[model samples]
Target: MKINLRKSLICINQQKLIAIFLVFMFLGFTLAKPEFASSYSINNILCTMALYGIASLGMTLVILTGGTDLSAGSVMALSGVIGAGLLGKAFSAANPVSLPFAATVLIALIFSGLIGYLNGIVITKLKIAPFVATLAMMSIARGLVYVVADSVVQGVSGSPITFMNDGYSLLGQGKIGAVPVQFIVYVILFLIVFVFLKYTRTGRSIYTVGGNIDTAKLAGIKTNKIIVLTYTVSSILVGISGLILVGRLSSASTVAAKGYELDFITAVALGGTSVAGGRGSVIGTLLGTAFLAVLNNGLDIVNVKSFYQYLIKGLILVFAVCADLFMNKRVKKS
Candidate 1:
């Protein structure tokens, strides 16, 4: 009981510190660029957070199990392309074909889930390291994007597929009074995941597996299934993000969401989630997502060069990983 209490306190303290830092960062940005304080800029920041938060939530789950999915970015692109194709935007102008929004989403989820399942099988059955397995999947998915694009587009094998339905696009761009639809989707996903992780048996199993797979198996937890489920779930979330992204951009391309896996890792780690696994929260991930979004928006407002922004973000990621490792070591000692 005492140990659990101590851990809880530590978690709260870390979250508080992150919150304080976020407030200070926001204020500094607003002061530096007064325009940033405007409602428009604030909305944009929230939108950015939502875009990244959706994927990071899934990443938090996979990472919690001591596994990582480097193919999330590629999966996002693949799902987007497939979803666009199913939406019938790629059909002939004279013979336009379109499916319901629900169908499009379902198709994308299933396709993405299949890819995620493949990642799981490779890791579990073949005994491949998570990093190497996911890296291979990343390449496979990226390469397949051209094949999907070719089937959708007539001339170019890698051309972008445009989504023409305004209603479909509304999922990404619509606002309910003042709240953006995309952010609403993020909040909904966050709440569902938060409850799942905090209040469900399977969620506990995920933590158990990440903390120690052998121990989990000894306890009859079916660790393999848990791992596969986590990867599949992560991919489904990525697929959802892909749809939202396509709606937002009104187009899907093979290059969409390129290099986002690194950003997802950075967000999960920044949220105080140990890279070694077994400790983290949905709320913390959300805060971390906001931090990254705000930092990028603020940097842009301050006219920071793109190259400098990349350097700063990369340094921040390194610091986050180091911090997580240090914290994990301390917890073990305690």
Candidate 2:
């Protein structure tokens, strides 16, 4: 009982320390500009975090397999274009376009998932570098976006929902009392992925395959299949992020989600996922995502130039890597 009590106290202390640090950090920014800390402003920041967080969760899994995805942003663009095209006629209609919206999202998700599976196949069976393979896929996916959105937004509301704020309010624009719909969605995805990875056999296989392909294979794991499945799952998450972005914007362009892959990768790395692969935590990635989001949000509130934001983000990523290296060296020495 005494040991358990001491353990509980240590856990509580850690939680409080982290909470205090984060709270004060945000508070510092808010203090710089009181209005920036307003409820609505905070909500908007969190809303954007939702979209990126979901995408990062998927990317985190992929990186865990000693592989990285450069095609994530392109996948998001392609999915958005596909969904927008399908909503062409129904976009601006007075009635709810949930049917087409649902179908478009479904198709987009399935399409990306297929592409991910292909990535796995090409890398594992064809003996291609995951980086080179994903890079090629990125270019191809981005090109497809241009092809699909050639003409561009005609006159559609591009608005997927109309009933809640004409389908623009809740889930996208509508808040649950005070919370944003996207925020809730992101939380659900985070929890689900976190649990699935921590508790499931298939999910655990990812770490195994990533740790050592030969060892995993000898242990009777279908390494190739696992690799393919990981990519597919990651792609599906990108599709979901795309749909949310479109829903929020009420429009989609060929250029949407450009450079998102960098942000996704950076978030993963900041969360302690080794770029070389096979070491990361979903929770860490989530915290990393939040840290980035909060940084941007806080800076924006303080009126920092966008240019500065870019510079700062790059610096933070470097710092995270350095810290990771230092920790690794210390552990080795010990």
**lDDT winner:** 1
TM-score per candidate, in order?
0.91, 0.85
lDDT per residue for candidate 2 within 1-334, as digits (tens), equals 9977865554423123333445776888877888767887888788878889989999999999999889999998788777766554433333233344567678878988987888889899998999999999999988877766653333432222212123322445657778888888889999998988889998888888888888999999999999999999999998888877877776666778888988998878777767766667788777777777888888887888999988877876676567556645654575
- Model 2 gets an lDDT of 0.76
**All candidates' lDDT scores?**
0.85, 0.76
RMSD (Å) per prediction? 2.8, 4.8
Over the stretch 86-135, how does candidate 1's per-residue lDDT look in tens digits?
77865442215567778878988899999999999899999999999999
Per-prediction backbone clash count: 0, 9
- Name every residue pair that clashes in candidate 1: none
> Over 4 Å off in model 2, which ranges?
1-24, 90-99, 151-170, 327-334
| Count of clashes in candidate 1 | 0
